[model samples]
Target: MRVLVVEDETSLAEVVRRGLTREGFVVDVMHDGQDGLWAATESAYDVIVLDIMLPGLDGYQVIARLREAGVWTPVLMLTAVDGEHDQAEAFNLGADDYLTKPFSFVVLVARLRALIRRGAPERPVVLTNGSLSLDPVRRRVLRHGSEIALTPKEFALLTFLMMHAGEVVTKATILDAVWDPAYDGDVNIVEVYVGYLRRKIDTPFAEASIETVRGVGYRLLEAGPAGPAGPAGPAEPAEPAEPA
Candidate 1:
């Protein structure tokens, strides 16, 4: 998962970046609150590590603005102040979790993982659509209890789709959600990754679950021997909507 750390303290930020990178997460750091806020808003970050005190904008205002704008990306607020009132305020402003200074690196990682899981729909880190299950945190996938190996990007794509299972998602939406905004969109990388996913996630299974909407996009449907069936009636005809 990608994590954006908004901190003005140079040494502290470096420590966090190094520690988190070593933990296998893609990390980005910003010294100013406005830049942090923009990156957090524009980029595909799983969790945002925001410090309370900042330049240009304070963490309180940043968090408030993000929540007010309906950005539900999970946030883990960090502050040197350990006051209960401050914690309450941060949570009220939509911070998913909070940590004070002098914290252990391990505890922070644990908290981050816990908060991401809480904010995300996946429980037990296992996403299920019929018998197919992918454990994102563990980077493991199983179909009918059989293990399947998937590359990091393929796993990220599958997890993103499965997380929004049963909902039709557009290519642009998928791109922005699963990839960084800096990614080149002119190429057919999304299609290539989808093909990779199909080869691994769908071919081994008896029935296909990922449905391509010719003009709209793709939807991860339930795998059924009788074909796709859901409460919304027959799956809507596939169509990839114009990129947003």
Candidate 2:
């Protein structure tokens, strides 16, 4: 496995490099936050060992900036201070693992291996599209950071559309994916619920995001200059959600 180590302390960085090399890893060390961030972005490493304290930008900023740019490489944070708030901040800023100073190299190796095993960027948090975001686990939806209320059926329908965002999903497709086989309602019911969804998600925004394909179906178009929202969801963060 290849690893990127960002540590300002030269001795500590070398020790980490030697230890990780002993553990079957190809290691590269960067002592500045700017250099580390550049290396993290330019190099393809299986995992990153980042120190929270560095020049130019801190570890938290490095992680956040990388994530904002869609570089989802796994980050294992290495720091000297130990505090509950620090740990929470690391996670909030997208650190996968945290370790205090004076740590065991063995435990470090073990955590690095575990982090690498989990593989790609699989965050526990739900996502947002356009001005809309939903957490199915919590049955909640948010628009532009403000929570938007949705009824059970409305939530189901919106979820279906957002899942197929940018696509011209027909009423029949909505019925099959959202409603139960036992449902005996008119397929026109899809239009009713689509209206319900618009009341909260789209109408609140300046430009209407959802569009109708005369006599065909409906699609959620992004309000940007780059064509419609496309099947990708929203502007850029149209996160690829799994099959519901």
lDDT of 1 by residue, 159-243 (tens): 7787678889888877755654356765456776776777676656645677777878888886553433233323433335323
Per-residue error for 113 in candidate 1, Å, reads: 15
Query: Residue 68 in model 2: shift from native, Å?
Result: 0.9
Q: What is the TM-score of each predicted model, taking all chains together?
A: 0.54, 0.54
lDDT of 2 by residue, 155-184 (tens): 767765665667898888777556543468
Off by over 4 Å in 1: 1-4, 8-29, 32-48, 51-75, 78-96, 99-124, 223-244
Q: Residue 187's C-alpha lDDT in candidate 1?
A: 41
Please provide the root mean square deviation of candidate 1 (C-alpha atoms, Å).
9.3
Q: Pick the candidate with the highest TM-score.
A: 2
